[model samples]
Target chain A: MKHYNIYVTSKPVIYDPAGRASENTLAKLGFSGIERLRIGKFIEMQCADDVSLESIKQMCDQLLANPVLEDFRIEIVD
Target chain B: MSDFRFGIVVFPGTNCEQDVAHAVRWLGHQAEYIWHQDTTVSQFDALVLPGGSSYGNYLRPGALAAASPIIAAISEYAAQGKPVLGISNGFQILTEAGLLPGALQQNASLTHICETLDFYVEKTVCQWLQLASGTMISLPVSHGFGSYYADAATLIQMESNGQIVLRDTQARIAAVCNEQGNVFGMMPHPERACEVLAANHPAGAGGTVFSTIVKHLEVVR
Candidate 1:
């Protein structure tokens, strides 16, 4: 089985409200010099060796991630 | 009491199907609950995807539910220009299903905003709302992800196409219709406001929204 990692996040134009609120909370905790914080989803899945990255990408594009609100990246470990 | 039937699609986590059914029945139409797994929606004259954290709202609200079997059936239903209304989470599902343009993101405040606010009905391609243009009505919005997000170009196009249906008092997009105008999606709970027992209903501005749909069906039928 091949393991893959997918990172999904809101497009830059779409503000990550929860991330912004968390950043605010961290600031309240006295953390300083933080540049930015954004919340996103990470998915890990396993497929058969014959499964192609193209299929995985298709899955992400069609269902795993919503193209309208988010962008996703797929990664596989050597 | 009308023979027109409105099917309320209920995803597993959907919690507002009953409210929508009640409102439809109150307006004197037959209301039925159709499960997400159901493959056919042909019998219903109108379709409604009610609110609630469908599929537990995991992987983003309405994501899973949007991919369910019922959405595909309803897509065809909407193509026939049948009236389809999606409220709150239902709106999320519809957008996700590509029945409507734009996506609903988490509220900018990052909390579930539950409040009754005034929304201005816009003259648009929407068939569900028969109220006069610019009419102000009170409706309750309760959602953790109710803020609407669409790129500038798309927003402009929707505005010009008369697809933008309802806006908040501050002019933020609260509801929208497809280019065809048969499908409507909004973040507010009009069912909650269409109470027959409430003093405002039938007389209040937003209270007549459901009745308007009932009337529309009468004409279309």
Candidate 2:
């Protein structure tokens, strides 16, 4: 079996409502100077060694995530 | 004084019957509760599948509930263009029942979502959403599985055919209508709004959804 490290991140321009709400609350609490905030996800999936990198990429594109709002990177570890 | 007859299907774990029933009744219509075990589609003008875990959220959110006898009758009714509105988990059941297309997966962050989501109208042709294009409505969203997934061709068709009804400002879809456009399944709980009661109206302003359906039925009736 092969192990892959997947890093999923929202688009730079996509608004993170959860983070925005927190930033507002934080500022109201007197914690100022908070610049930018972005939230992403990390996923680790094990696939068969015979699974080509290209096929895994397709899986990530179709079922694993939504490309319109999210972008992902995959790297083979060990 | 027989007004329009409506029915809300109740599965083992559903909890939104009263909300939906209130919406239906408030519109000068009638709503009856239909148990999941019954295959009969009660004499109703429309059917609502409210949100909640059915069958303990096994195999998938709505996988089991879709196979219930009531669901079988719902499918038949939907084929005849009787309105079928599925909210949240009910949406999951519509997909599982094959009444609607696409599958709902876990959130992108793999976390449960419980927040107010803004949904804008994408199709004016839809009976339930006859509002102007770009009308925004606030609705509560509470679920772990609400990510919509479909093949490339189906997605393309949905967009071209006006089946994609409600989307967020950023264009991430929040809801979709079936091919016929009479069957709608959405992740947001519009019935959860405090607008269900006159005293708590502002907080529950989501009653517009029920009102919209009533208007459509009136036009047809």
Best by DockQ: 1
Say which docking band candidate 1 falls in: high
DockQ of each two-chain model: 0.80, 0.04
lDDT of 1 at A20: 87
Q: Which stretches of candidate 1 lie over 4 Å from their true place?
A: B196-206
C-alpha positional error of residue B121 in candidate 1 after TM-score superposition, expressed in Å: 0.4
lDDT for each residue of candidate 2 in B17-129, tens digit (9 for 90 to 100): 98878866766678899999988884887888999888887756887787787876898898888788999999988887778888786676657988777778886456667
Interface CA root-mean-square deviation for model 2: 8.3
Question: What DockQ results for candidate 2?
Answer: 0.04
- Best-fitting candidate, measured by TM-score? 1
lDDT of 1 at A3: 93
RMSD of 1: 1.8
Candidate 1 residue lDDT tens string, B5-83: 8899988989989878877777677899998999999998888899999989988788899889888889998999999
